[model samples]
Every structure is written in C-alpha cells, then in structure tokens.
Target: MVFEKDPTSLYQIYPTTVAVIGARYGDELNFMAAAWHTLLSFNPPIFGVSISPKRYTHDLLMKSGEFTASFLGHGHAELVEKLGRTSGSKINKVLEYGLELLEPRVVKVPGIGNAVAVYECRVLESRSYGDHTFFVGRIVGLHYDPRAFDEVGRPAYDPVLYLGKDVYVKIDRSRTIEFDPEKFRK
Candidate 1:
C-alpha cells in the first residue's frame, strides 16, 4: 500500500493496560488515571509510573514516598476519564465519585477496593525525563481479586486496555491460549 513519514506523539504503542495510581500525603488521598506504566523489575517487584511534575498526584507521591497501583476493569472507564480530566487540587475526586478505597496492608496510602489487581509500593528511586518524571517503587504488598484468575491461578486477561484519546477495550479471556514455551525454543 502507501507509506507516510511522521514523527509525532502518535501513541502507537497504546491499547495499554490502564491503572489508577493512588497516593496519600498524611490523611489526604488522591488518585489518577494512568495508561503509561510497567513492571520495572520482577525480583524486587519494582514498578514505575511516569507522571508530569505539574500534576497534583505527583506532589502527593513525593511528599508521601508511597503509592498504590490499581488495575482498572472495563466497567471503570467512565470513572477513569473523569479523574483524568480534572485536577485533584480542584476537588476530592474520590468522594466526588464515591469511589471505594481499601486499607493498605503495608503502606500508608490507600488502594482502590474494587480493583482487579493492586500493588502497594514504596519509592525506591525517582528520575526526570523531559516534562515527566519516572518514579520507581519497590512493591511492598500485592493482591488480586480471586475472580480475576482461573482455578489453576492463571490470570484471566480482562484488563481495561487504553487505546488513547478516551477509547478503551477489555481483553477477553476466551481468546487465551496456553502456549508451550519449549516448543518454540531455538
């Protein structure tokens, strides 16, 4: 077909799993919808989220040195977009939405009680890259809703994957395949 040359912020690597980051400074709690995040390390369970320094959640993150990553489901897309559209400094979004929160097991911050998966992390390192800052946190605690996994403990892939620009899709577990890794070995 045809080819085009463009080097813009085209978010080509989207359809990414969405998560709502939760942070608390003392008694004040905040949450933000994030599509850019990843598991930085498996051994230490380090997780990282890129945040613009201007965001109110970024301030809470630095002040508390702790945060929670809550995996969102398809049902939460509207709530996710609402949080992304406004600044937490303007209103208490948690109370505004009547979002349920969980008592964190290891950190002072809170986790979304209705989350399919949750990770409570304590900051290990933070570095700036352009307008955004990457904060690496060591996972201190983790949990997943029992219903999200199969009997053998394989996770049912039903996460809300953000396609960018306010679009999202939930992965279907029925399309799953249990591949044999050794069969493809070189």
Candidate 2:
C-alpha cells in the first residue's frame, strides 16, 4: 500500500546518523547534533551542514570560518541526545556533557575524542535558505578510530541513527550487503 501526503511528511524515510558539529571561537568551544549534513565533493573533500540561524554554532562559524564534523558510534547515544537538547548559547556543552575533545591537527576546532570519525573543515561559503543556512566547508584533514574498521578496512561500528522525536536506532550489520554495481550490471 502506498500513499502521499504533504512534503513535510517526507521524514518517514529517516533514522539517519546525525553528525556532531564541532567548532571553536577563540577560547570557546561547542558541539551540536545535526542530521542534515552531506558530502558535497571528494577531490577537495567538501562537506555541508544545514544549520538554523538560531543555533550558536552558526555565529561561531561566521567568525572562526572553520569547523569539524564528527560521527560517533552507537555507544554514544546519550551524548548525542544531550547535545541535541542543550543550547550552546546557554552553556558550554563540552563541559556540561563531560565530553573529551581531541586536539585538531589542521584546524583550531577540536573534535570529540569519542567520535569514530572526524572531518576538519574550512568554510568556503554559505547561503541562506528559508529558516536554515547551508554551510559548505572544504575538508582540510580527517581522523578516525581504528577500532571502527574491520580487517578489510570497512566500517565495523554499528551505525547510530536518529529517528526524530528523541528516538534512536542502530543498523544491524548482519544484513549488510557488499554489492558491486559494475559486476551485477545487466
């Protein structure tokens, strides 16, 4: 059975992994959970995150012009939930959450030490769209936890996905597919 509704109902296909956006403004540092992020390029390693103007990170980026995108393993769901609920404008999330941060190799912003993977980025440009703004950043460096990968250099961590309304889920790796499009092409 199939049906249609307002475009806003498109959230039905969600349960996506949210990226923890990390940035620093002078001595200030903050982290927020964001589900609207994507890789825009590979060669130069461009990445983008949709941020609401009301978010504190937006102002941090506007001044610092740099940030880090981090993906935490499913084990850190508590941290993710806490980040999403708190406002950086009110308190320091890193200290409030007791999150251990790693020193950035290429940028001033520090990434979550618990993140399975992290991308350090420099803002290339940003544009307004409705109530949210899209920040496009060029990745300058990346780091990852080796435990997150397997013998074949493939991700082994159970993916952490946010299902909105405070729900969270993890991908069952047992059903994971190793598909090869070129070999199966008809």
Candidate 3:
C-alpha cells in the first residue's frame, strides 16, 4: 500500500462558498464572504476559517468568540461576490442583501439563510498568521435542507465555485467526471 502518515500534499485545496458571520461586542455585527475555510476535525466537529486581519468580521469574531459558516448555492453567486467586494464595516451586509438571519442555539452570532447548509460554531482556538487569522471552532449545531438530499441520501448542492480574483463559477456535474477510484485510480 502506498500510504504515509499526514499526507497533506496529496489533497488539492479548492475554493468553496463560505459565509462567516459574527457579532462584535461593542461594535456592529459583521458578515464576511470567505473562501478560506476547512474542516479540521470530525469527532468534536471542529472547523477552521480564515479572515483577514483588517476585515470587520475578524475583530467581531475575536471579540464574540462565535461564528457561523454558511454554505451557499448557485443562486447565491451574486451575493457572494457582493459581500467579498465590499466591506461590512461600511455597508450592512445582511440588511442590504435582504439575507435571512437565524439566531444560533448556543452562540450569540446569527446564521445565514440562503445557505443550503449551516454550521453554528463556537470559537475553540484562534491564532494570527501573517495577514490573516485562523479561528478554529467547535461546531454546535448543523442544519441542512431536506429537499436537497437525493434518493441515495446524499446532500446535493447547486454549483458554487470560486475562480480567484473576483471571479466565481458554478460546477456542473453533468459536464465533468467525478471521482471513481475503481475506474481510473487504483
């Protein structure tokens, strides 16, 4: 068997739709569109999301110690670009976009509605690295749209992919070949 412990280089990281929302203790609440997010653990249901040091949500997340990651679908492509291009500090993201907000069960931060799946998370650890800070969270609750599940019980989300530098694309499964280890890779 060709295997090694901690083979981090084997995986190719691609951009995904991530909506990060947090409330600032004294300042206004902020929601940022992020593409840098990953699941760090599963047993405790932990995740890590990165925010720029200068972002409004960054400070809010640090102060509140809670955040929500909302996975958007193809319909939310425009909203994603809008949130990423503009600053939450200047414009009210949720208000301007008419996004639905749901109160978290365990955390003070609100959740986004357009997301097909939402994860309410409480900050477990945080660290500053270079221009951005990574906040690791312990997932508190999970929600998904029942309609999105197929007959096989797999959650199917609409195409939502980012193409770097103000460009976004939707993934069409019909046009691409999905992973099949038996057919291609051994």
Candidate 4:
C-alpha cells in the first residue's frame, strides 16, 4: 500500500451517517444534507455540523442561532441526495420535495418527519476552518423513533450512510459483531 502526505483525497471515512441540517430564520426554512457532522461532547450534549459559507443554510443558521440535525434511514437515500445537490437559495426544497416537517420542541427549526432521530440544538459557537465553518450547537431537544433504535441506543434500522461522490450505503445488521475490550486486558 502507498500513502501521500497531501490529504486532499483522503475520504477514508466514507460510511458516515448523512445529517440533514435544518435551519429557519423567520419564515425562511432550509434543510441541507451534510456528511461532515459529529457529536462534539456528551457532558453538555453538543453537536457540530461543518457547512460551507456559500450554503444558504449557513446564512439562516447564523441568523436563527438554532438548527436541527435529522438522521434519516437508508430508504430515504434519494431524498437525501436531492437535498444535498440542490440549493435553497434558488428554490424552496421543502415545498418541491413535499417533505413533512415535525414541530420542534425546543428550537425554532423543525425536523424531517421521517427522520429516525433528530437533535434540536441552539448555536453555541461558530468558527471558520478552511472553506467550511464549524457550527457547534448545544442539544436542546431530542426526537427519536424508538423502533429504529435498540435498548442500548444502537441503531436497529439501516441508516443512510454517505460514501461521497453521490454514493450511498447502509449497514447490514446480520454482520454486526459485539466486541468487549475487557477480554484484551494485559
């Protein structure tokens, strides 16, 4: 195997869940599919979504100070792709796609009705990192489909995983393995 110092094409982490970031400012609402998002902290329940400055959602996020990270199942891959490719600035994606939005509990932004899990967050901070701005948010509310998650919070349903370059995949639960670190104790 060979490796390069430049990390331009290093998208090794391909199977990450696609996070549909929803933001609203007044009557304007937008949802963008983001492959670059993760849980920042557990103590204060913080989440972060890396969005480019040119995205319409970025402007709404800054003005609203709140957003929702909605995780959809594998069945919605087509919808996710549509959301990622289109720009909210040019058209109303929600109306065009006929997306059903759920009423938010804590934040002003609503989540996709079909989402398996949605995290309603209030903006904590935003900082520039390269071409994207990392928006850190404190989780204010959580909505999850109980049927989609196991008792220990493991995903029971196939989740939409982005593989970059317009590709998508899902988990095969039949191949899942449970590993215990205690067995490897020195």
Instruction: State each model's CA lDDT, in order.
Output: 0.87, 0.89, 0.75, 0.93
Higher-ranked by lDDT: 3 or 4 = 4
Clash-forming residue pairs, model 2? none
lDDT at position 1, candidate 2: 27
Candidate 4, residues 112-165, lDDT tens digits: the string is: 999999999999999999889999999999999999988998998889988888
Q: What tens digits encode model 2's per-residue C-alpha lDDT throughout 141-173?
A: 999888889888777887668887788988876
**TM-score per candidate, chains pooled:** 0.90, 0.90, 0.81, 0.94
Q: Which candidate number maximizes TM-score?
A: 4
lDDT of 2 at 185: 93
Q: What is candidate 3's lDDT per residue for 1-186, written digit by digit as tens?
A: 343554344334555555545554554766778878888998989989888888888878877888888777877778777878778779987789887876677777767766777788989999998668999999998877777767776657674577666667766668865576787765
In the predicted model 3, the residue pairs found to clash are: none
Off by over 4 Å in 3: 1-15, 24-27, 151-154, 176-186
Error of 3 at 154 (Å): 4.2
RMSD of each: 3.2, 3.0, 6.5, 2.4
**Pick by TM-score: 1 or 3, better one:** 1
Alpha-carbon RMSD, candidate 2: 3.0
